[model samples]
Target: MRVLAGLIVASLLAAAPAQAQTVFAPDDPGSSGQPGGWVNDQWNFLPGTGVDAPRAWGNLIAKGRPGGIGVRVAVLDTGLAYADRGRFRRSPDISRFRLARGRDFCPHAGPGEDPCDGEDAYPDDPNGHGTHVASTIGEATANAIGVTGLAYGATLLPIKVLDRDGYGDQQSITAGIRYAVAHGAQIINLSFEFGTLVSSARQIPLVLSAVKHARRRGVLVVAAAGNAAQARVAYPAALPGVVSVGAVTEDGCLADYSDSGPGLDIVAPGGGDDALRPGEPQCRPGVALRPIVQMTYAGSKHRFGLPRDYVGTSMAAPHVSAAAALVIASGILGPKPTPQALEQRLKATARDAGPPGPDQAYGAGILDAGAATAP
Candidate 1:
């Protein structure tokens, strides 16, 4: 099986609180009832500890685009629970957002053999990872149900490169990248990376070429730095022009499992145990922090729940992707801003973390969606 850069530990079922303070209420009522409850569970969107999504939401609301409207973000990973067909069911919270008819690049022989059979027209997520990542980028805001996506107004293109087992080869991933660019995806979120063992970009020439192709086409590619806790970042993300994102915990410290090194661009909330950093009060080693929560399949594709084990740089990349979409919609960099401009804005507006300047661990620092899209 091909190795995925992200780590998926065992999960526990958790429910959202029924009541919480409302931050920014969208005009549209969500499919579910409790719009305010998202504030209770989503600490990753809070002011200091998280990305500060409310500020971004308010900015977008003033601009008339509530959640990065018109931006198309392509999620390249295991399929998403986007559509309901056969045994699959879309996550209740994610159902409200607009989705493109995404393609499945990884095709297998029989349905019984692989969950992601090539027969389907839509990229339905058999593994919950892609769905979780997509939801983080554009799940649906103020929709009462589970949680709020940073760019809920943006269109999501679910490109299934990995199989149900969360394993994918270079060919499928390469195809997925090219497909997203050709399909007008403004931002591509790559939440999975090659193993740390596959260190050199020379090893994955096709994937690297595809990423460069996307960059040339002005598509912003955001990727996970990897979760190996290694000094060097993993491939694809480490590639030039791609926004390499690392993971930070609830305490705003680097996640214990997040890989760090040169080429790392930014950091976001991935949620889990904090790394041991002397003098940093937030870095409480050994304490189990709350994981990034999103509505995903409980165990089977038929059931949907909030699983609290989704932690890694894989989880961190989508936050940047969503922020990129918001920046695109905000008109801060004009209507058609280049990927480089978007990256620079996100890094420049990011809240500084770790050391004094941009370090290897925290990159440009934790993502601040509110400030990045501020008018």
Candidate 2:
């Protein structure tokens, strides 16, 4: 049986790429320069409340040379498909980040399906979750187009462990971790997770072992705290050496669906639109929290005008992963800081959100991209 099911869809507001403006109207798809749009506002360049990814970008760009070009992030999820052009109907944003081709654990299961085979090659995301997660990490920033990611300068190593259904077995996931570690992913984003892990050794030995392997090699593994409303920790997230992340609303309250427990590392803006769940209270348009925005497969070819809605801990993990990228790119931690040192930097610098310091609800606190990457 699957440990968990996919989350309910949030209120997906579509935005068209219009001329730069400051309006937050639904009629406006959204531009990259407006504070009303959280992606451009709270998540990007705007000061104080924003994650401050653009600040890191600014420091790097001002140097006249690109930063984060050498850091490689491994996205272990469904797959990566940005979009397409003349000869290609699809191109992953990982390409825009200029990352090398990583391995796909699943063998092609014919057209329109992704299932594992006997080979250690080819990773493509048909299910969209992986692509959305990747976009949050490095979707190409400040291009006068889509919303930016935290570390647009970093390269990607997309690894397709999960198939179309958003589920991957312990074997595939462990193998994927090993591949990432061996191939050199300084950071690994585990946006998908298994719920109700009873005993690590009994339920997921390989998974735990893989995490340890990554840690031994100085790789930081960031994972989702799961979307369960039941205030408990999930596997991998609770596992040692992994940074567990939960979701919080824009106002800094814990999200309605975010899971929490002893090991959660931190929280991020994982927009919650109650309307997405049936029978749940419907939040008025402006009054409701805005979901995180990024460019990815919307199943309807690249529609640039509409802001796509995706809200969950899955969305939160990458923000931290990208922040890790920014920290590495910033050179603040030195050319080769140990994984433990980098993780401590993240936890120590995080903005305290609830109960003063390091509460289970918000971990160390909400991620401070600005503080984490500041020179």
Scored by TM-score, the top model is: 1
What are the runs in model 2 whose C-alpha is more than 4 Å off? 1-8, 11-48, 62-67, 82-88, 91-97, 107-120, 197-201, 273-287, 301-307
Residues 118-223, model 2: lDDT tens digits: 3455665666777778877877654544555667778888898887678677777888999999998999999876876543545888888999999999899998
Poorly placed runs, candidate 1 (over 4 Å): 1-5, 10-35, 109-116
The local distance difference test score of model 1 is 0.84
Which window of ten consecutive residues has the lowest lDDT sum in model 1?
10-19
Residue-pair clashes per prediction, in order, are: 3, 14
